[model samples]
Target: MGANAAAFASLLRGATNLSQCRWILEQLINSRYAGDIFLGNLALQMFGKLHGIGDARALFHRMAQTGRNLFSWSIMISALCRDGHHREALGCYHAMNLEGGIEADMVILSTVIGVCSALQNLCEGRKLHDRVAGCGLESDTVVHNALVSMYVKCGCLDDARAVFDATPTREKDAVSWNVMMAAYSSRGKFQQALEIFNDCLLHSVQGPDAVSFVTAISACCGLKDVKQARALEELSCSHGFLETSVAVQNSLINLYGKCASLSEARLVFDRIASKTALSVRAAVMEVMLRREEKFCHRFVIAFMLPSILMWCLGLVF
Candidate 1:
């Protein structure tokens, strides 16, 4: 019976007939079945992935009535989270409290933190933070990272930094570092954010992946450092996805203009190659032209790049 459960779990992953799979589950229900706990939990998970919350919820309720274990609880919480029913998911957590004897681990804590962020329930989220500390999981790096992101999402920058600083100075993972950097970047503390980027590299957590570069380039734009920003753009080129993000391209143009390197700025601008690219280009030129206006006698705005015509006509935005 356990082997049959395992086979069902695996076959369910393939393009099997849904009606056939439903019939098997029905058979398991009727015949004094000895289904594997792992397989039942797998069904709960697979339903979430294949259908939606409606499907996962039905399977979850079935698992609960059969007196399944904590894995069932985690699966249900995760399914609710992925389906964006964050408030309801948090409600499930509270209702299940003192009932399942389930100890929330890093996976559950991280998912719950995301749910809080999605629901924008900062107060309940903070209460969960206290619960994490009470459980002595505060020092766990994954939990700490989740807390920092939760604070960031809630617009509590000060609290985010407080939790980040409280992290033990031991080696931090890239996830931890990235979340802190993202928080600071969001608040326009780009210099401090870039420092975190450096620390990310130094700690060997990771070397500038595309997302990391995008975040770091954001900081560079705030600092108006074209040279360093261009270097990041070049590094991202090595990742084989020649498709640069619009954010990256826009930031590069701004940095170059701020640094007064109009030639480099024009080069980056031309590569954008899109109609909507005009606004970011306009914004960059607007910022630069506004600055260069002080020297209006010395510089002219027209005839820099081919797209200067488009920049002139206000089509980019």
Candidate 2:
């Protein structure tokens, strides 16, 4: 690639506007590098970001008419997956495998695993897991993470935990811990989630990120353990998680309300810098309804008029 082609490719990569992307794509097509596979893949990526799925599919088919490389197949498959066309993405993945020349790599496997996770297709997920092992890519942390996540989504917690246990400690990141906690929490296994979360805190390899705290706190909410929830609130606040993450604050509010600690819930609500996205208002109403039943009506009239309006407008419960 020349300076001009390189610059154009960079432009495509950075482009956020669909119109500009189309114009730049047209320029590339009329230029000397029109037949370049890299440039074609770049166009496909730009189209994918634009959510122009039809255009992206057309581009992929056009590219395949001449030939399709591994990157080309991966891009198309990933684009389809991003566009919420999992069936097509799976079809493309299988088709790529049948194409005979190109072999699926870790990147492709990761993307396909995500598709399986989204679709919750355990059978296909197992096949892909086997393929990852057979290709000797099972040691890859990212691919292993994807495989674990897929099994978790498929409701195979045992399989997910097996993979989690087998993965080297160095290979396990915050995502690995979060996935296991989420799997347990989703299945109403809050005790297991909290245990994994404690282990996460103890090991501190990748350290606990916002999702880690939020997931564990959510598990605490499910269990309604006021003491543990309060401790998590302290940990989250001490870590500056509350300052940076609205989701953490929201989770804290919900946790407090669930634990019948209405004062702490109100404190969290008040501490939130921006309350636009939180469900704290509902948490307030819930606390009032459950714990302050005698004053619930008066509280709604005095302090929850916005919530009343939201209810009238069908925007809230």
Candidate 3:
């Protein structure tokens, strides 16, 4: 019966029919589970993917009645996020604090961090982060990466940096390195990001991704590292990064312009593939053209952002 439940859950994963997944979960509940913890957790995962949070929650509660386990708790909390029930999920985390005599493992903490990010509850995420550290699960790389990403996405670059700094040197994978670069570049700290780029070059084991390159170029734009930015732009092409992505060229345009090289920016813009690219290039270009005229007239502190404000300028001028 337990094997059947797991196989049914596996089958449910491939089916997009939420109703069918819920039905299978119901079938599992109607029949005696006989303390089959694995099948219970598997059912929880299937319902989560199908967005069947109500049924998943019910099953999780049933599991608790039958000498509940950690897997059941994590699964239910994760499924609860389908409708943005982050706060409820956090409550679940606290409720199960002593009942099961189990603290949140990596999976549980990751789900809570994700919830915290959705709620923009950075303070809560930090408190949980401290818990992860105090509990000695800080050595877990997956949790470390998740914490960094959650902090970065929530616009708490400082917290992201603190997490990055605390990451053990041995566990710093490419994802961890990229997260650190992103945390710095996100807040316009391009100089520090560039130095990280140099550090990445020194590490023979680490190979940065296109996302990493984009972050480095973004840092260049902030620091007006036109020369180094230009070098990276050329290197991207020479290394055959396929220049297929509009984001890559867009970064080039922004970096060149920030380096005070409008002409080079134009060259980069002209080379962009017209297909599969969003209209943001046109929007950015409009703003860049306006900045050309106002470079001597106004402080224009918010160059790229000023493009939206230029729509009002267009109506006036």
Candidate 4:
């Protein structure tokens, strides 16, 4: 029985689609090992991977009748959340808690926190924050980042900053810095955003990525500090983002356009190897709106040419 159960579990893991998975489950039921906890959880994971949430939920209900474990709950909740069923995910989480034996671990905690972030449920998010504290997972960097993102999305900057500051520096990843920087930038706290960007460079081992540069450049744009924006342009070049990231290029174009440095903006726009509609629109809008006397003809040529070409190619949907 043990060897047969293991073989069925292996078959389930290798199953690539719903039909294959169902065959394995049928084999398990016929073999009278369908109730095995490990096999049951493995089946749930495969169902989730196959985007079979409906099937997974049915299996979960059956497993619950016999008994479910931590892995069972985690897989179900994660699958539901992945499918954008945030409310349903929360419902499963509450059921798991009421079940009253399986302790919530970091995996479920982070996931549920993110569900709250997606739903923007600040009240539920705050309750989960306390649960994290109770579980002694407040020091976990991933959980801390999730909490920060939740608060920021909920418009709770103070709470986000509190979590960000509490995170140990050694554990802070690029995500940690980017989320905080973006929060401040979006709130019009440009100087604070730039301060965080500088601190990220000086302190974080992970340093910055393209997103960090984008946010910082946006802050410089908000302040209209051409000097600082130029410095950031250089930094972006040094970090190898200027050549690779279209987002960084777009932000620079907007920054230079806002600063009335049309030449520099044109330079960035001209260098894009593959110009997206956004890049073209940014250049066109900035030129037409910022220095119409200088680039009015250029805007008509730049914007209309590509748009006409896209329409011809049936790509303008």
Q: Which candidate gets the maximum TM-score versus the true structure?
A: 4
Taking the tens digit of each residue's C-alpha lDDT, what string does model 2 give over 9-96? 8989988888888888889878887778888988898898789888888888888774569989888888899889999999999898
Enumerate clash totals for all models, in the order shown: 4, 0, 1, 0
Ranking by TM-score: 4, 2, 3, 1
lDDT of 1 at 255: 65
Cα deviation in Å at residue 11, candidate 2? Answer: 5.9
lDDT of 3 by residue, 1-317 (tens): 55776676576567576777777666766766635677677767887877878877877877776656787787778778766788898888888885757767888987788788788788888898889888887757888888888888889787787887777767677777777887787777767888777777566265666776777887887788677977888866865552665666677766776777866765665565552223245335534664665432222333334665777899999
Cα distance off (Å), candidate 4, residue 27: 3.0
lDDT per residue (tens digit) for residues 1-317 in model 4 = 47888788779989999999988887876777867888899999999999999999999999977668999999999999988999999999999989898899999999999999999999999999999999889879889999999999999999999999988898899889999999999999999999999999999998899999999998999999889978998999899999999899999999998899888888887777777878878888888787565665675576678778878889645
Q: How much lDDT does each candidate structure score? A: 0.69, 0.84, 0.72, 0.90
Worst 10 residues of 2 by lDDT: 294-303
Q: Find the 10 residues in a row with the least total lDDT in model 1.
A: 294-303
Reference-based lDDT, residue 216, model 3: 80
Off by over 4 Å in 2: 7-27, 267-283, 291-317
Comparing candidate 1 with candidate 3, which one achieves the higher lDDT?
3
Error of 1 at 188 (Å): 2.4
Model 3 ranges with Cα > 4 A deviation: 1-7, 32-35, 120-123, 150-159, 242-244, 260-262, 266-276, 279-317
Off by over 4 Å in 1: 15-21, 34-36, 169-171, 227-254, 257-260, 266-317
Model 2 clashes, total count: 0
Residue 291, model 4, lDDT:
55
